[model samples]
Target: MTDMQVQRHAPIREQVANILRDAIVDQRLTPGQLLVERELCEMTSASRASVREALRQLQAEGLVESHNGRGTSVTVISTATARHVYQVRSSLEGLAARLFAEHASDQDRAAFRAAVTELAEETAKGADAAALLKAKSRAYDVLFRGCGNPVLHQTVQTLQHRVTRLRALTLAQEGRAERSADEVTAIADAVDARDGEAAQAAAMTHVEEAARVMLAAAEGPPSH
Candidate 1:
């Protein structure tokens, strides 16, 4: 089926949820920006019920919050929250890297290596934030698939929206994209060599570095 037809065949609520999730992660729906149900319905061309269902789904994902008498708005990730999220991410992603290294087949490793290469090329070429997000996502897709653990995959998928937003935040910083690409390359290299310990260490280091960069950016210019 055509892409458009496939999308239409999907449940309306899920389609709307994906649309809003993309918008929120990409910052088209900025943090703390109020989401009006009627406007969302108009935007998605979905019914009010579908929009509400989608909003509820995002709320569950910590992407949006609803307030009494105030409706819903995109979530604002405070520095503290971001730090905590990164701590959990370090563990989860480190495990994924180790598993991918230990269990991935030859073909999976090849695809993963290619994905990392594409990500590196994109960063080297000074690709835009959206392009970088797509490339990084493709690499993560390969890593998760090769990891061979359904629980890990599901858990990471739950946190992916916020993880993506934080990644976008880091990528926007000066010189972060190239560094991030290099860090991912390290993980890929370790996985390719089937060194689980090295892959886990590299993955944790990548997340810790991203957390450092994002926290530094969140802190803004130090005292003038």
Candidate 2:
């Protein structure tokens, strides 16, 4: 667990939840791993009450599960569940792309292009998973901001944690990181041209390809 300095001005439970969320998405806390409340309290230097609240928040976000006796564990995303997530993600991202292309300011478009360039450079250099994920997230932030719809942004943000975890899985596949960068570049290009339809198609295609790679990887080696 990373060291956390609780901000005196902010709510501790929210801070704790964000910390735990990042750990899960970064794969530091693997799926199905038991998350003991006591250990979490110690790790975050938070009180039991705060830790429990954070766990509750994570559970609501679908990042963790609780059972009567099994305790709390990180949620294991099945291939079927992953497919559903990707379907929704495809629609949301497609809409965001189209909105950005049609309504974003010139400054927003320039910032998005710069973000995509950083993502592409990171992938080309074979940066670690964490770095690549951060770069991609920066690009996404630009997209969400340029979309100019708080409701759409909030809706997508709700699924951010789960989508990030699946993104890590896809990035681990051989050659996937490079292709993923290219896909984003395509979306960026269409956005720059203010081509709403093309941008939406590229964004949806990116999500679809990521789903394909992730589901295939989950299947493991086929029997001879």
Residue-level lDDT of model 2, residues 52-101, one tens digit each, is 89999999999999998779999999999999999999999999999999
Residue 194 in model 2: shift from native, Å? 0.9
Best by lDDT: 2
Which stretches in model 2 have alpha-carbon errors above 4 Å? 1-10
Candidate 1: residue pairs that collide: none
Structure candidate 2, residue pairs in collision:
none
The sequence of per-residue lDDT tens digits that candidate 1 reaches over residues 1-224 is 12212166778989989888888988888999999988787677788998989999999999999998689999999999999999999999999999999999999999999999999999888889989999999999999978999899999998898999999999988889999999999999899789999999999999999999999999988997
For residue 62, give model 1's deviation from the true position in Å: 0.8
